[model samples]
Target: MKQGFRLIALLAAIALVAAACGDDTSDTTTAPSNTSTTADAGGTTTTTEEMMTGPTFDIGVTEEPCEGGSPDRGCILLGSVTDQTGTFAAASPGLLAGHELFWARVNASGGIGGLFDVDILDSAIVDNGFDNATHVEAYQGIRDDVLALAESLGTTQSLAALPDYIDDNMVAAPATWWSGWNYPESDAGLILEAGASYCVEAMNAVDFAVSNFPTGAATVGIVHFPGDFGEDYLAGVKLAAAANNLDVVYEQVTLPIALDPSQQGAIDAVLENYADVTFLVMGPNETATIVGTVAATWNASGTDPRPFIGAGPTWNSALLASPAGAAFEGGIYFNSAPWGPWATDTPGHAALRASAEAGGAPASNFVSAGWVEQYPLKATLEAAVAAGDITRAGVVAAANSLGEVDYEGMVETVADYSGNSIITSSVVSAVDAAAPDGLTLLAGPFTGPTAAAHDYTGPCTG
Candidate 1:
């Protein structure tokens, strides 16, 4: 992996040199010739010169102001490849809205280094359809037109475009929370991932289940998809189940499109195993199907239903309006999140809420996720601007050099990128029809003993 990264970096350097030497006037690198003033996080006024001459940037940046932005600043265009019409389609709009709102707020607050207003234009946004080939094609379509990807919405999808990202020195905020994003070698130091990974979240979820619903020698059943998303969560559950002395008696690897679209196979597996608790790592529709079916079955049979815990992506507040609505309201389901819900009490959450309200964006956990995911990228861009080199390679370097990023209390502060310093804590929530986003906080922003003690080495799926 190290060798691969070195080779990719070498090739990127050669490509940059070739582009610089070519007759392509559009590929030229130039430093901003104007002076700009900005207030630092400390609220102190600082001149751009204090850092360095304006950044020498290439690609995805222009001297022209962003759409709807002040004409005084240049525009930094970031691309996005997300699910707009796929299995996760219901969650994509909120995620994109969050990305837009975050940038809007940044532009309103004087933009990056007071020189560039960032934009993730809808025109540049591509729909990946939650398919790997579609994701690769979507990325290829916009690779040359953007500075970086503000969002790439799946584990396999991002992985498919990763080789190209490394070759282009493009940095992206991964929408998926696979544990591999935390490792530079795994992702070529390019994925600017936010929040706890599905791996850690699963571990914390298992611990939460055991602590809240104690059953001596409890048994656990896992229903998941087969790839990185599901496999990563499965790995974590195994670790936590071992630590808690819980028997994992059932495991089902299936797809949402399968199981008769009702997830009958999964529901039957859960019923047969009758584990004290079940963990789900699938799409929202599948989650609703399995959870609702199981709950309804138990109720009809006069049997008490066990709790069903879902990974972040497995939930959508819209489920409350489905036939699963009654089942969800019956306290048979819980969810593990990378951060607090939409109504979390924090400066960041407050800002997000304000942005959503002002923009009329839908209230959804995916929206909060979309907002939270941008913090690392925002910090990286700011670092690049401050270092006087907002080029593609410069952005990657800036991302790696950061020791931390402030999330304004939305989640724990992001640790440095040089090692496995990914946040381990997770937020746990339960269904609440009356709560914002239909989720009420149960416990969270907390790390389970298993996750806290687990050895950090590499991707769980790997």
Candidate 2:
């Protein structure tokens, strides 16, 4: 619908070219046409005319250049629906900065297919506040203006918009790592997810704890919130526990709103079971409260502190300054991450750091995550361009056809979109005050036996 003005302008240009050719009175100097030929996904050769003119598009693309792009190039606009002022607000800024930085680099290097510059306008980025309804509302507002979503954060929040996304033929790079994103049956092949799922991460976490702390980790406890984020991880923890012959001594599911001033319920559960190791699948605040309280209680009782492994979202560098800082520093907390931290030695990490430095963005693992998640979308768009069709439906086709996305070693390359190809390895990190993100790599990008051997038929939640 937004293509009206551009279509009119294109018609006018065609009319002028035709009129000039018809005029025999004046000596007309014709400019040489720039043309190229390429092969499509099916190996059919297409010329520039066929590739450029045969393809049709409706919204979120324009013949006009982007604000900072060369006048000769067109623009492809994308949107982002994410938390800017909600439960995940602390990490959103860095995540957004990472998106901007990634696109900036892309535009600077000559954007997709060397034909269009990509832009995610600030006006098109709406704050979902980590709420499902808000996420849907934000998406509805920008559905007609963006060719695709560059970032859609949260598991349930993204799921809330799935039906509309399918109807609109919109593709998105999800910010959450829910296991459901791996299956086309669950995501309808619309979500371009990066890294390992939360479920697999939990499996690896349990495997890491049991293998590393053999003397102390014979039993495990799980503390989580109720929905996909928590329950997904719980499923994997249980699977790994059974695989390793470790008993699940405790399971506590509590809400963030309920645990606010005090995480007494979760802490009491931990104390009662006194499991050697606990897997946390809650927010950073909840993580800090439970770890801090449990550590203090254990010290008071003169009991040795037990190790706590947390899913990626449950650890933030800011927690290092909270009351739990000492407990984290005492080697009691570890993070199970989808990818390496900000300081990982990889080409992708280096590029992200350079972009962040140029933009003066703060160092955070969320920034690394945000940067990593864009790869799948970038690959899909490129694929669509090669297929001579960048329309919404074409983009969806490109996404489903992708074989593997190169993250430049930020994490293991996602082999494919199938559930069987789901990445199972995870990076485990330990609290370190001196590390760039206050966390240092302790073990992984490694796949433990449980995750490596487990059959992934569908989403853990299902």
CA lDDT, candidate 2, residue 111: 86
Top TM-score prediction, candidate number: 1
- Candidate 1's residue-wise lDDT over 324-367, tens digit each? 89999989888998998888899999999999999999889988
TM-score of each: 0.88, 0.88
**lDDT value, residue 145 of candidate 2:** 93
Global lDDT of model 2:
0.83
Model 1 misplaced stretches (Cα beyond 4 Å): 1-53, 214-217, 258-260
Q: Which stretch of 10 consecutive residues in model 1 shows the poorest summed lDDT? A: 1-10
Taken over the whole model, the C-alpha lDDT of each candidate is 0.85, 0.83
Model 2: clashing residue pairs? none
Error of 1 at 345 (Å): 1.0
